[model samples]
Target: MKKYTADENRYENMQYRRCGKSGIMLPLISLGLWHNFGDKDNFDNARTILRTAFDNGITHFDLANNYGPPYGSAEKNFEKIFKEDFKHYRDELLISTKAGWDMWPGPYGNFGSRKYLIASLDQSLQRMGLDYVDIFYHHRPDPDTPLEETMGALDQIVRDGKALYIGISQYSAKETSKAAEILREQKTPFLIHQPRYNMMDRWVEEGLLNTLEHEGIGSIVFSPLEQGILTNKYLNGIPEDSRAATEGSYLSESQITTEVVEQVQKLNDIAQSRGQSLAQMAVAWLLKDQRVTSVLVGVSKVSQLEDNIGALENLEFSQNELEEIDRILKKD
Candidate 1:
């Protein structure tokens, strides 16, 4: 395997923000392997994307146990790239994986039970070729399992050195507050919260952000582009090679209605006025709020990563621009 040497000035332009009240600092833009880092994906393209992201100062890489089509293939593939390129720089990276979703067939393989969380992390660490992950998340709330049991598993993982910090994803404000209290009682480092937040999806602002702020939990928002809807790819109708047309993709063609295209076109005008792409403006809008620790972005190509990262160059928004956006999005 050829060794990879990262850019010596990789940190030059990358802005790092404190994760809530924690000592850790994450890049304004983090890479998520939720889309193309799988067995069915091209390994070389995936490797390039990872390399470009890291070179551009994206130190945090997010993954989940059930991310791939076959479940866990993303971790397995990432392990190969990590060992070949990043093993020597482990301390410089923050890798996270979740396990709350369904991962296997047996009753013990899914949910937030102590057995499932523990076993899942063990398997995750093995697949990633790491003794510990920077963060471990309960992918989603499991109403079937006791919150105590699920949180207890996270506390145990930190204590056993299997994970450095604990986080929760797709959790409601009420559920987040409850989980934070439990983790606090255990004295675990409940570092961050991963929520699906974007220009189109403003659910996080509906009290989830307040909850995280109250608990001193940092937030890394996923889908800042709203599954490509906030980008130019959908402006001229979904392309045959686009995610909306791809089978099994979370973004379906039916979801891209004519109204959505019109909205996107109007939003693109705002982006062009700001001298940025629609995607760049979308990511920049999220960063305007200090509560957002980082905006998680997924890209299939290195060019996409570079284009998205350009949002950092100009994050400022005039008062009129903000109001105009609201007017467009809220105009039914």
Candidate 2:
């Protein structure tokens, strides 16, 4: 492609929020590479998505070691894109990657052992062609490993200069408190948490948000659209190419029940009344709460990314609107 130049006025429209009590200020909407950006996907589109995100002032880009269809491909692909387009603008970006899922074959390649966490980030750094990532997350809670061991590994990574900040993903409210305690004792810069929080998934609201606030840890929530269920893509029915129609996808067809479609339709009405798309409203709903530091949005197209960014236009909700949403969500 031709030479890329980021918009000079990118920061003017996008809203930035303080990440808990940290010096870091994250965009209200962050880009995620959970879907697309793999080896099998379009490379040019992926490059454009990254460019568009930065052009729109989305500084934070979230990725994981196992993000691609074949593990490690996303990082490798990102390395190429970064060199081609963002090499000079590296300081202007906030790049994050996680490791804690089934990455490779063997006992030492997975989980929260110091050996695994340390080795995994080393490999991730190598693949991404970076000395250090802006943030490195543990990806998930390891029930078998001790919390101290996991948090200690994170602390070591920061002290080793592998990652500037440490984060954890999908950890329960209780587990998050324990992890934060350990990191505090270690004096690590435990900056953030990544959780699956959306209108449909309210698990974070139970206590996780409270824990993050109390611990002074920011949260960048994933699956904010509930794997596309919160969007209008399935309002009529599951499209032939939708994630739900594809076998082995995280969102199964059965999960999109009649009740869900009904809920989405009602929710869509509210979105229209608010002059936003369902996807936009879904993101706004999360941003309505100050506890959520940022919303991690994964998109297949550049237009979707722009639409999500449009959520910054109207982040407010009337008291009646909030109760209506609660009532609709509570319906059977």
- Model 1 scores worst on lDDT over the 10 consecutive residues at 1-10
TM-score of candidate 1 versus the correct structure, residues matched by position: 0.98
Best by lDDT: 1
Q: What overall lDDT, based on C-alpha atoms, would model 1 receive against the true structure?
A: 0.93
- After TM-score superposition, the amount by which residue 302's alpha carbon in candidate 1 deviates from its true location, in angstroms, is 0.3
lDDT of 1 by residue, 156-264 (tens): 9999999999999999999999999999899999999999998888998899999888899999999899889999999999999988998978899998999899999
Identify the runs in model 2 with alpha carbons over 4 angstroms from their true place.
Answer: none
Alpha-carbon RMSD to native, per candidate: 1.0, 0.8
